[model samples]
Target: MTLKRYNMEKILKIITGLAGALFALIGLGWVIKPAAIAAEMGLPLLEGTALNTQIGDMGAFFFAGGVITLLGVLTGKRQWYYAAALLIGTAGVFRVLAFTVQGATLPIDKLIVEIVVLGILLASAKLTSVPQ
Candidate 1:
């Protein structure tokens, strides 16, 4: 590969790694203390057995994603980008579907952010993908 192409691939891996780390960080927050995070987001801080079961599920999901993606980047395995794409892109798609089903319950800004993340993730996946 050309030096420029190699550099681009490295940059892409780093970006993906960073994104995964942030995702894990947020998930950690959700895992560590869902009540505080939920309150900050103006969500109901439900307190009960059922709440406990549900609260950490998202945290675990993102945390696993982050760990996997970071490991892939560190190992120079470009394939993990596909996992990140699937996780993030699917989330964005589901968000849009929710809007369609629920009629725009989330704020426009939130939707925009999700869409942007999805776009960037997809572009990054495309940029970094190669036949290995």
Candidate 2:
């Protein structure tokens, strides 16, 4: 039996769809403020500290990125998909940098997940034949 070569276009489509879903889920998590997430993650719900404010800002950015990615997927806009993916990827890199600078224990699991996602996005961008 021989395995068939995967179609790049099809893979990109799936990647875009999955990325959109993941972003939307992240947005929903931020909007909902579930107790389990808060307790497990030590995320404060209501307090206006510098850290909290920064988190809120990042949350807003993530929410918007999710929406944009969803729209790009639905509309078949390769450029939009690439743009959102790059933005999210860059943000993830910055997040890791910040964690390191703060002398904080890195969220290895989350960073790995984000790295995987970023790889998918980059591959999708290439497979879709979209100009970077």
Candidate 3:
């Protein structure tokens, strides 16, 4: 059987969709066991602090966004995908900013990975054409 070549747009959409699903899984894991995540990341366990609360909220948002992104991908809804991509990309930027503002250095590896994912999503958003 011959392999079919994919255009950049299709590849980007697949990448973004997969990344969104992965993010959703991560978020679900965090929601289920925030303490486990904290321990794994060497962060303090949730003790009802403002920072922890913020983290929780962020996690929830990410989870919801991821779900929406996945649905958009499945439905082939260009607008939904674009909106989700923008929202998640903006959130990723804010996360990096938050890390910097806390007198902590940004984790380059994490930031880079997030940036790549966002880039793929953005490219996919632009590449997708609405069905007539």
Candidate 4:
């Protein structure tokens, strides 16, 4: 690879790895301190089964997305990037839906993060490759 391309790969790997770790940590927070995480996310911790769903579903979403992203970076696996991209990109799509269809205020900050991360993952998937 050319020097510039190699440098770009290294940079992307570091960026994606940090993003993955951040997401996993957030997921852990959801499991360990659901109320605090919920408050930060502007969500309420509900009672009974709803609370269970909140912790379980949200935690799994973030944890899995993060783990898959890390795996992609570590293993240079394109498939893992595609998987993470789909997971995060779907969330982005739904955020738009919430704003347009559900009459919720635009979650612009979160959406920007999601789109940026999704772009990085997609670009990484295209640029990175598995070792033979």
TM-score of 2: 0.71
TM-score of each: 0.76, 0.71, 0.73, 0.95
- In model 3, residue pairs whose N, Cα or C atoms come closer than 3 Å (at least 3 residues apart or on different chains), thus clashing, are none
User: What are the per-residue Cα lDDT tens digits for candidate 4 across 17-67?
Assistant: 999998988899898999999998999898899999999999999999999
Q: Give candidate 1's whole-model lDDT.
A: 0.68
lDDT per residue as tens, model 2, 91-120: 778778888787766777767867876777
What clash pairs does model 4 have?
none
**Which window of 10 residues has the lowest lDDT sum in candidate 3?**
1-10
- The sequence of per-residue lDDT tens digits that candidate 1 reaches over residues 32-75 is 87878677656786668767765767677678767766765665
For candidate 2, the per-residue lDDT at 90 reads: 83
**By the TM-score metric, which is better: model 1 or model 3?**
1
Residues 1-132, candidate 3: write the lDDT tens digits.
123324665676687788778778767767787777657555676566765674677577668778877866776667767677677778668767788777666667766776776677666656666541
Global Cα lDDT for candidate 2: 0.66
Please, what is the whole-model Cα lDDT of each candidate in the order they appear? 0.68, 0.66, 0.69, 0.92
Tell me the deviation in Å of residue 80 in model 2.
1.5
